[model samples]
Target: MLAVPYPYLIARMRGLKRGNHNYYKTLRNYTHIVAGSPFAEKVMRQAYELTGTRIYKNTALPFAWDLLQEERQQQIRREFTNYFPQSEGKKIAALLVFGDISKMKKTPFRNVNMQELADSIGKDWFFVTNSQELAEASYVLPAEYRERFGFVNRIMPTQNLLYIADSLVTNNCRFAGSYAIRRKPVHVLRYTGNVFEKYVQEDYNDMYIGQIDKEMVKIQSGQMRPDQQAFCKEMSYDNPKEPYGVIGEILTKPF
Candidate 1:
């Protein structure tokens, strides 16, 4: 697992912080965008700063946040070495999970379609449900090249699923883990949402931070086994639907 440096964009946003309430509010909104918080004046301001328009107010904030995350992923790839082997001489196939995206009603399987779109662009492509699906799907390929493509299980969370999906489209090998075994001309991108959100709080210097730090230390020292990392990846301050949350009533309209 190569560590990608946090984007300077984040640091630049954070640098705008001042001790004043207005400044803090601005910072909070900027963080909200990254955390997929609902729309607010502050969030709108941050979006304008980044995109020069208020397009996100009309679009879903999760999608907007995903775009930002994709940009960050690109930055990571640019700065880090290739982790997966080369795919120059072989064709590739991808298997993606249709998780919550399938439940969206409006954009179900949009990501899966995106994968097909990538394949149409040039790369040989196929889609399957699981490892067994891979085996069944393989028989459809030409006999000479039946072994050139591989299957990947799409049993991970959404966030990790996108990472693997991005890797497949870009032909980045660093994310092609053990699924590359058998030299079957295939690559695998397993979804791992176990560490989806960590460190999503407003105050990192508070007692909560100390407690989190202690838990992290325990995990690092092998004294504990956590199902997921101790971190908050999303912010809910602007979401009116969230319990005990408050964003301005004016911002809650379905405009």
Candidate 2:
């Protein structure tokens, strides 16, 4: 069967033995394995050395491309505003795609004070985050600012909120790759997790939160421009064919 491993798995492979690890053995069973970016491909190659495993492709196919279209972005903005009316008059900033409280210990946001972040971000912005994240900080979050933070009880896909958000603040998760497509400013909290060195160093949109307000203003005002093309290159978006077309060719052809 074809396998499209998560980007993190590619990073983790760096710690595995060259040819003897169970994960590498399991990977051997797949007819084809895909890496979503050049950074991922490099890691996979280094980790899988002497194991007879190789990446079949490097393409970013899983991103929400349709959502980035202008018409769709407008529709999403309307839908988002309808659901969170507090966002109607204000610029929206989002904390994205985190799951359980226990899992957070592994990321840079583990020690971040969400209440302080909220207070420091100023009054012109409304914040969106998951319920669990809100609850994790709510006890300490002031009552007046609590209204500025909104969340849905049910599962709200990160892309919809991302489409309308003026900026994003997130840990180094795969979902943060959407910055390449969205071309917005993303303030990445610090963590030296297992990831490509170039991926962390070269991307223009990713930054620390030391002076978040000033950084945000610079980004929006074009003083700090993000190089979308450079970021896309890191994601291996160089293939001339559409990503779906490339995937289809791989699936239908002899392996």
Candidate 3:
């Protein structure tokens, strides 16, 4: 069996001094490992070197492809509206919340009140979030916002929802890369959360820089014009093709 760890984990490992000793050691046993970026590949190679284990074959590729078909946009929009009737005639903005780091009692996190953020952006737009985000938000988000926003509790593909969404709002979210295929306006709220904040406190050599506050006036007005090409390139998603086919070809044919 092949090992394909999440790229975020690999990035976190790269941020660490020794790349989490035992984890990479165990990864040596896999026949092949897939890396999502050059940085991720570098992390794995360094880890294998430290363990004195032979580094297996691996390739760095974009995590997701352009699954947003042009023809399917309307179909997806209609399907989305069935679930989120309030979203009709309003631009959809996806608020991606991975974990409630702000309300945690374990450590002091820069207070991130998502409620206020959502309220500021939802003037003419409607919001959507998954069940996990909604659950985490219950502690901070009030009932009005919760009731107003659409909750995708089912096993629907996120790409489909994003296909219909006009903008994205994320805070320390893992699947932010997936949304990069669309190259729409994205507001990155939080990055320094979880163990990353700890790394910052210890004054370690951290590469993860926190980007906060996109202009709310532009974002809410649907006038935000970010460099789409640059953002896609940063995520290594400029080409946007199915990754599995590329991986298969890489395994079968020599470079």
Candidate 4:
């Protein structure tokens, strides 16, 4: 079996200072480590120097992120007909909340209460996350709007959900890359939260640095950053094929 670790555990394996002891030691037992992204490969190489096929080997190709076909989009619409009807009055927002992190000092919300955000944005907003975010949000959400903005426990072809959304906000959220590639307007918040906030935090990063107020106004009108085109192009892969076929060829054929 192959070990395909994402950035989650890779960033945690560390030693005293110079090198990563955990990855180096553990890598000795595996035939190969399949890195999903260039960032993941960089993280792995930082943890341990790549020796050969036995230690580490990467195809260097990102996972297939082809554009969502029209049929698939239609199917998703049909599957979740209630959530999205005609897509006119949507004002949809996809908040990728991994962990609450509201308690953290530098968080976007900072000292603000979670429930406060409920009143800030209009209706038709929803969250896309597993159990962790769902549990974190249960307490802070205002009771009246709970059913208005529902939660998706899980969705097959997860990218479909992002396609339906007009805006995406995330904080160190793992799947933000997917959203960027889909050409959907993505906002990587300084911290993660289930409740989507329209308040633009300019000091958070250089992306929203100078024209933050203006950008906030634009975002309110459902316009994405003009600079995100390159990002979407670079990160997206239109190929429908999986890399597993290459893995099989490599194992069977001599080189």
Model 2, 113: alpha-carbon shift in Å? 6.9
Identify the runs in model 1 with alpha carbons over 4 angstroms from their true place.
1-56, 75-131, 136-148, 154-255
Could you tell me how far off, in angstroms, the CA of residue 154 lies in candidate 1 after the best superposition?
7.3
Model 1, 21-140: lDDT tens digits are 222322322222322222133323542343222222211233223323456545433322132123333222334422233334443222232322333323332222233533454555
lDDT of 2 at 50: 29
> How high is the CA lDDT of each candidate model?
0.27, 0.54, 0.52, 0.45
Quote each prediction's TM-score.
Answer: 0.25, 0.63, 0.58, 0.53
TM-score of 1: 0.25
> How many residue pairs clash in model 1?
9
In the range 1-255, model 3's lDDT, one tens digit per residue, is 222334445455645564465444546554445544433455566555333333333232343443356667888888888877777888887755455445565422244455665666665677776635344654556766664567665646764666677877554323444555566765544333544233322432122224322234346766434443344344442443455765576478543
Residue 75, candidate 2: alpha-carbon lDDT: 85
| Regions more than 4 Å wrong, model 4 | 1-5, 9-25, 28-34, 54-69, 86-91, 100-160, 192-218, 221-244, 247-255
Instruction: State the RMSD for candidate 2.
Output: 5.8
CA RMSD of all predictions? 18.7, 5.8, 6.7, 7.5
Better-scoring candidate (TM-score), 1 or 3: 3
Residue 146 Cα positional deviation in candidate 3, in Å, after optimal superposition: 9.0
Return the clash pairs for model 1, or none: 83-174, 84-173, 84-174, 197-231, 197-233, 198-231, 198-232, 199-231, 199-232
For all candidates, what are the clash counts?
Answer: 9, 0, 0, 0
